[model samples]
Target: MTIDEQTVDKIAHLARLELGAQEKQDMIADMNKILGFMDKLNEVDTTGVEPLIYMTDEPNTLREDVIKQEITTAEALSNAPDHDGSHFLVAKVIK
Candidate 1:
């Protein structure tokens, strides 16, 4: 399919883009070239080629999950900028 100025204008409008007359003409030419290349690609024969799913053959590796000791309340609150004994304090967000 060939791209024309009208098609370029429609595409630009749909994409919310502002293009000048020269830019619209340039875009039409560029789009036509791209479509021409795609048309050439369509001429290639691939009768029995299997569609690719994954690029690599290796399976995903996973690590075993193990139970671990949880940090104490004091340890968890150690990095707080302002804390009231066991809980963090912050400025009131609601009126």
Candidate 2:
């Protein structure tokens, strides 16, 4: 699979990118080179290789989540500029 000028144009349009003529040409060349390298990688022998999930084989240790402190709703609303006893009030932003 090779990238052409038309393919690069379509890709640019999909990505909402505005490329100059030279940039477009460069993209085509770069994309074709990437595909060529991928094709070469596909020719390598890997019949008995295991897929790598991580770089090392160490178990991840996670600590339990515990609430250290708690506060009342009134305490939380104390510093608000505007509130309605239970909820905060703000200017209407959407029509």
Candidate 3:
């Protein structure tokens, strides 16, 4: 497919972009080049190629989930610069 100035203008507007005349012309040429490249790619034959999901052959390596030491509430709140005994305190945000 060929890209024209009108198409470039419409695309720029949709993208919320302000393009000058030179930039619009450049975009039109660039888009046409990309479309031409895609068209060339379409001419390639891939009759029995399997779609690739993963790039590597290695399987997922994960460690077993295990619980470790758990700290008490008082221990957790000990280092807080501002806290209301149970929870950390912060400045009010909502109006």
Candidate 4:
């Protein structure tokens, strides 16, 4: 519909924005222009047109994930400076 200064002021207030007299007037004209453009778009006939999506027919062409067996615990703990049995020992962080 038509945008007025009062409508623009209400919108600005709702959005927690402060607009001066000139700014409010500018917003009204800009909003009316936007609404008029939308109205023009509404005149087009596209009843059977499908909604647009992000992608086309291109495949991902990604490689499959290769599952390898994990290393033994002893092999992992071998590099550690301090280890009790299963996990590495470090200084207590929490007090």
Candidate 5:
């Protein structure tokens, strides 16, 4: 499709692009060239081409989730400078 100068100016306005009269004309020509290339690509034959999902053979590599042994309260609190029974105490996080 042929893109007119008015259409190009409208597009520039929508995209927030600042262009002079000559630049607008140039941009319209470039946009039409791109559209022409796309139209030419439409004539090519692609009867049975497989869609690419991934580049590598290994698509997914997820480790199995498992629960293991944990640490004791005293062991965890040993290094803490402040604690109260089962909770770790510190300066106020917010006013």
Candidate 6:
């Protein structure tokens, strides 16, 4: 389907865009060209072609998660400007 001025206006409004007269016309033309390209792509033969999901067949390799204590609670709280013996103190933000 071809893009018209009305469609361009609607798209611009949805995207919170403020288009000038020339810009709106340009958008309509660009959108029409994109649609035309999509229509051309539809004419291609793909009778038994499989959709590509990934570029490589190799499985993803990830390191296993290990739990280890890197620092004690006292060590973590040492540099705090404001703390209530065990926890950091901050001004109340929410009403």
| Tens digit of per-residue lDDT, candidate 5, span 45-64 | 87797777898888698999
State candidate 3's TM-score.
0.62
Off by over 4 Å in 4: 59-95
lDDT of 4 by residue, 17-61 (tens): 999989988898899999999999999998999887757868778
What's the TM-score of every candidate structure? 0.60, 0.66, 0.62, 0.57, 0.54, 0.66
Q: Report the C-alpha lDDT of model 2 over 13-73, residue by residue, as the tens digit.
A: 9999999999998898899889999999999999999999998899888999998759887
Pairs of residues clashing in candidate 4: none
Cα RMSD to native, each candidate? 7.5, 4.9, 5.9, 10.4, 10.3, 5.4
How do the residues 2-93 of candidate 3 rate in per-residue lDDT, one tens digit apiece? Answer: 99988888899899999998998889889999999999999989789988899998999999999886997789899998998999888899
Give lDDT per model, in order.
0.90, 0.92, 0.90, 0.90, 0.89, 0.92
Task: Find the 10 residues in a row with the least total lDDT in model 2.
Answer: 67-76
Q: State in Å the error of residue 69, model 2.
A: 8.0
TM-score of predicted structure 2: 0.66
Tens-place lDDT digits, model 6, residues 1-95: 98999999899999999999999999998999999999999999998999989888999889999999999878888998888878989889999
State the local distance difference test value for candidate 1.
0.90
Off by over 4 Å in 6: 66-95
Residue pairs with colliding backbones in model 3 are none
Question: Which segments of model 5 are wrong by more than 4 Å?
Answer: 53-95
